[model samples]
Target: MRSGSASSEFSRGLIDRSGYASEKFAEGYDRHRLSPPPAVLKILTLVAQAERPRLVVDLGAGTGLSTRVWAGYAEQIVGIEANARMLKWARRVTQEPNIRYVQAFASNTGLCAGSADLVTCAQAFHWMEPAAVLREAGRILRSGGVFAAYDYDVPPAIHPEIDPAFAVHFAARRRARERLGLQAGSATWPKEQHLERIRESGLFCSAREIVCHGFQEVDAVRVTGLAESLGGPRTIFGEAAPEVEETFVHLREAAERVLANRSWPMVVSYRIRLGVK
Candidate 1:
């Protein structure tokens, strides 16, 4: 199990990582990441009809993947991100006429009060301060507006032969956390727990959930690209520290040996939870 002790310091460290010079991380993630499942649109549409959402705010919008999803539907779509590199990439790559980007933390976005008709966090609630962000969501959203969060549960690998590579990858992650002294201090928790946290916040009414599944294919190149784009975490933790890099390299070599020349299908399962203001 992952730790539940994630702290502000850790979050700050992530915010300071400053992404790659060429924005490789943002590009890779946008390319390989799962598409916004239908449930996200369904929920947004359901709420849009009731509130006639003119302004949609996507917190932790990262590379604008989630922000672009609302382009044609909303009169204006604003993507807020803490990381400058991510916002830069989002601004450069996504050219929607009605979509825009801003650099801001999820916990405290400097948006106008009651300006949003809908708020969303896609695969990013884990990194936020739940109570603070939820309170901020409530502050910015119009009365009776909607808030929704969703994340995909990626099962390392399904192919038996390739599973071993994933095993090594997971072990490396555990070791990396241990080396960083984050095992007991960092906890992303599970996606489902996020829903519970929302309910506990008491900021919204009638919170609900929807489970959606997406299918895709993965090869060595895709998997490696994902690790590279996200970070050297799964394959090779670049220049961070010797111990961390060792663990990453080990996993990379192991995966390299196993996935010499093969590809397999992957099932990406997503759980989307929605609530009303």
Candidate 2:
């Protein structure tokens, strides 16, 4: 499975791994991050031809949020995560009898070959070495089994006035991160190329992309919590650089003013790339 040559590239992901290393970050992430949309289960099952998948493996499974979604749909589910902090929370909050967590790299899950009916990476695929991860996913997926990598768009659409401020906050964070040269620790592939990578891997017989949206009711606290849960933005904001702090304050104030202490419907857009082995 090209494990020998691919081993080095896997470690490159560790440099950026620290982005999610903080216990506080994990806690906020678990509390505020939106769980993957229900459509994921239906689509993966339909494509894999497994109404009830025998086994599902979730790679880069942060806090088991994505893994737990499949508990009722799969006979067994395993979450492979490398971060101790995230894994700790994953174990603590997870109560599904059929689900379990394993600390491991996405490129080397250590699962039995051909044992998984479906393999998924949700909101976490961009941080992985695509080719190496695809190789491991291919090795573990049975013929006709599906491998799907999906992510949601950031700054979920809330209110018109608040959305622009949200964009400003994130853009300011990006600028601060670049100005500080904090980008050296990690590497990431462009999300737009996920479908292309899956198709070019040749391990999959076919590949395709899907678009979906999810809606949830959220209050002002949830809005700010979502902002705080972001890795890069959180780090940049923690520095309390005047401009960035001002941007965050602007967002918070906007949310509070616009929502008026009431819950508002929020929409998150998701992109899913699928491959069939």
lDDT of each residue in 182-231, candidate 1, tens digit only: 44212555566877888988988768787777666777677655544443
Sliding window of 10 residues with minimal summed lDDT for model 2: 1-10
- TM-score against truth, every candidate: 0.77, 0.91
Off by over 4 Å in 1: 1-10, 17-23, 47-52, 156-160, 182-190, 217-219, 228-265
**Tens digits of lDDT, candidate 2, 1-277:** 2232455354444435346775477788888888887876788899999999999999878888899988888999999887777888999999999999987778888899999999999977777778888999999999999999998887789989999999998777767666765442223477888999899999999999988888889999989988867653365345545677888899999999999879988999988899999
**Winning model by lDDT:** 2
Model 2 has an lDDT value of 0.82
In model 2, the Cα lDDT at residue 246 comes to 85
262 Cα displacement, candidate 1 (Å): 8.8
